[model samples]
Target chain A: MSSSTDTQGTGAYAPALESPRSPYRRGKPTRSNWELHGWLFMRMSGVLLLVMVFGHLWVNMVAGEGINQVDWSFVAGKWSSPFWQTWDLIMLWLAQLHGTNGVRTIINDYAERDATRFWLKMALYTATLVVLVLGTLVIFTFDPCMDPASTLEVCRTGSAG
Target chain B: MATSLTPTAKDGPKRPVGTLYRGREGMWSWVAHRISGVAIFFFLFVHVLDTATVRISPEAYDAVIGQYKNPVMGVGELGLVGAVVFHALNGIRIILVDFWSKGTQHQRKLFWGVVVLFTLMMVPFAIRHLTFVFGH
Candidate 1:
């Protein structure tokens, strides 16, 4: 109400009046609850991301020999453990979903054209889906001993090398 | 005429402007918050792909992550750390402000607290991370 009355001038930086929180242009009030859900998700995911991401950085780059020690065998060793695998899996899922939703908000706010907004979000979701699927597969399906041509000590054996 | 010219917000005036942040600190903090968020989002894209490389072969995965060992990439890593730290700290501040009863009232003070904590958390980290990269 107040926002509608306040919108009169136009400029490059001009923001739109607050749109009524209803899908129907002039119908009954709707309770999609999506905005609330997204708000809560961002907060929850932020806390989890802090722990997962920092732990990841700390283990991979801070402990032991740091980044230099990270090689095929290093990853193989880590992924061998169920704890690390699940940690990574949760990190991957939460970060992707959280980041995708954030970008989606930006798109909705800035992309004025409906078609542009739709296509851009489509691309974002597509990229996110690809990463999520590929990362999940890589985490769960990885096998250090899968390669025959590999000369690594671990790859020589078939038993959880 | 006086009432009309006064432009009461609910009068459906020709121009409706939503409330915008006026404080300099708040504005800058808001900008940094968004930037850090976007940066993390972009990093996640690459990080996923890089991590996925592990699936190919140990050699492939090792080689991919190894590329980040360089000084240039080290600096980029520092930037990434900065973004992450800022985002996380600021995010906590935001959560407090939104959820805690007294948070919004002292949001300005809380922001400064974030900055102080950020410095404490990240400064030593940046120094160490850089030292690790260059010391090698």
Candidate 2:
């Protein structure tokens, strides 16, 4: 069949005939590579989230005094250490990115109109950015003993203020 | 009277419209992620506020948390746990969709698979959490 087609094309060719133009050329730049990177990020973040989330749970719910131990003092004590602060920071960033990218994909898929897609994405990104910034700030700027003077008597006992 | 004489527009093509949700797997992954994200955000807000109670007074903190020791709150905790678990698991699904060559083909299957796995994993974890908190 291949030989017959070759012979037909060569021997019976009309020299004056023009080739048909393709309707679909390489149109727009491909975005698949960027998408692939996003996909990879989801899995890596998910795996890391698994560890960070579970570790958080274990420490708060399973270890030491268990759930009862999780009070203001408990959080204050935990955040006082750089270890817990860093852990929380990692969790916050990973979860935000994973969640944001996931939603961005959704918005791209569901929002039909260009304006709708643009607005929704703008809102999503804005909200994500705000929350991430606020959360990181809180984690780093946390102060357990703010009113040290007025509440010194109570603070001394590790209960009141 | 005018309504009865009007002709209806015929359905155009069988093909769906819009770039949004064109891929089944990608669409669903996007959905689960958003749902989970909102859930986590609200949860974090409450958690931070709850922790802030300690700043007010220890008794207030204890009282707020003491309420969480109840059955209803235990159930709520389970819901939170479920949200976290589903979000984390589906995140893996999103990652697979990105990295795998055949990910598009298997997207639907993988999405559902992650959902099933999330439910399976969360059941025991949630139960254990509730038991630890309220079973006493």
Candidate 3:
């Protein structure tokens, strides 16, 4: 090791100095790959949402008598078709995922404490799961023509009956 | 006078004093995405409530739907459509940032791309939406 001994202080002095080192340090690996997947999901979901949302608009607003024609019957009719069912299923799934991922990212960025992050995410995930599952169930399991006797008066209309 | 340097002090962890500046891409994109998400969420609440009107009373349901038939509400629908369009478009931008390592490099471009695409896509769709909803 080449040592520079310089005596230029008040007395003849050479302070031993530690070797110079690089400031860069190794960082812990992040689950950024998963985040990357989620990112891709947002874009794909956005594209799908565009289609579902626009198609929904066109059908509800322009295709038929437009907004005036949309009623309980109209919804029932739409839900009756397997095509609309699938469309709605896709929309629900994508929207939930897109929204959930967005919130997840927000929580990760803002929740500084581990406990806070955990609880917030638990709540978020719980709400998301409940809504998504319930929505999907409602869309698919909806009985347009329920028993008139047990249903609302509107469902018991002569035309409906 | 002799002052000894302590190894522990020299090796002590340097705590960041202020907000750590992670060399990330533009913060505006994140902020926009967040704002749009919140906006969409707000609309979602209203939408679910409005749709739930059907369960209350058919007359009430029809009344709510009729409210949407007005010119003012029609304009509001246009704005809602715009919000969804922007949020979806910006969401895609956020996704691109997540997947591509080089995405941060083109953040400005991506942001502008989303804006342009949103406008182009939304214009025709919006016109069709308005006409369809209110034209007849």
Tell me, per candidate, how large a share of the native contacts it keeps.
0.71, 0.27, 0.31
lDDT of each residue in A34-144, candidate 2, tens digit only = 887887787777798889997997798767756657765677667767899899889878877877787788789789999999999999888777768777877777665
Please write out the lDDT profile of model 1 over residues A1-161, one tens digit for every residue: 34445555443444545567735455564778799899999999999999998899889877777666777777777776789999999999999999999999999999999999999999999999999999999989998565565555666665634
The pairs that clash in candidate 1 are: A5-B12, A6-B15, A6-B16, A7-B14, A7-B15, A7-B16, A8-B14, A8-B15, A8-B16, A9-B15
Which 10-residue span in candidate 2 chain B carries the lowest summed lDDT? B1-10
Encode model 3's per-residue lDDT on B12-121: one tens digit a residue. Answer: 75543332122233566566668878677656645655665555554676778777777788778777777777777776676677777987778778888987998897
RMSD of each: 12.8, 10.8, 15.1
TM for every model, in the order presented, reads 0.79, 0.60, 0.62
lDDT of 1 by residue, B29-124 (tens): 878988998998998899888878878776787778888889999889888888988989888998998899998788889899989998998888
**What is the C-alpha lDDT profile of model 3 across A1-161, one tens digit per residue?**
22344445445545556467735546886645787777667777788887898798779866777666887767766765789989987887787778878888888988999999999889878767766766677676665664343354445565663
List where candidate 2 sits over 4 angstroms from the true fold.
A1-34, A146-161, B1-38, B41-70, B90-124
The CAPRI quality class of candidate 3 comes to: incorrect
Candidate number of the best lDDT: 1
DockQ of every predicted complex = 0.44, 0.24, 0.20
